[model samples]
Target: MEPNATTNENLNLYEKAENYTKTSLELLKLKTVCSVADVVSTLTSKIAVGVVVAFFTLFLNIGISLWVGKELGEYYYGFFIMALFYLIVAIVIHKTHHKLIKTPIGNTIISSILKEKQN
Candidate 1:
């Protein structure tokens, strides 16, 4: 009888451990899903806003280029000036991209993934 009781206790312990492991795995899966959803949603919204801003910038630049050309008495000259401006801007961005873009984006992604649930 004592041996049978010992065997039953061992079985119960095994079952409890199994259940604990399953629960932990489920919790991990849930947290992963939550994090991915949060990141994707945030990115989607930001991209939408970025698209709108990009369009605005495009039209604004076109208008400015036209006005500058009118003032300078040549459309192509205005475009050349704008192109030169952009070339300088591009060079500046290329020089500082790692500091201005890469590090901030990497940190944002890491922080988003590791951020705890607020509720």
Candidate 2:
């Protein structure tokens, strides 16, 4: 082939490769967004569960404290004990919430996003 013609063909091939790379990057971005959305959905579902459980816990705590006060004949100590118990329960729930956020569903979504990025 002529020198100019060969150079033009090389330029064309370079342009095509650049275009493919751009397209692939865009697709990866889209996949990452979709995976993030999936993770958010999972979090939302778990949050709903947490809310219900929290309300139940609240009622149970109140009822138990009231019962203990009546039985033990000491309202002040009953209240203090209830407060301590709730503090411990809150700490446990906080840790559990963190763990749940890193669960398989969340990890899978994150992994998919990373895989898309790598590709």
lDDT top scorer: 1
lDDT of each: 0.93, 0.82
Query: How does candidate 1 fare on TM-score?
Result: 0.95
lDDT, candidate 2, 1-119, per-residue tens: 69999999999999999999999999878886877886788679988999999999889988888888888998766777899987998888788975764585567766756765575
TM-score of every candidate: 0.95, 0.67
Give lDDT for model 2: 0.82
How far off is model 2, as Cα RMSD?
A: 4.3
For candidate 2, the 10 contiguous residues with the lowest summed lDDT are 98-107
Return the number of clashes found in candidate 2.
0
Model 2 residue 47 lDDT score: 88
| Candidate 2 ranges beyond 4 A from true positions | 74-76, 87-119
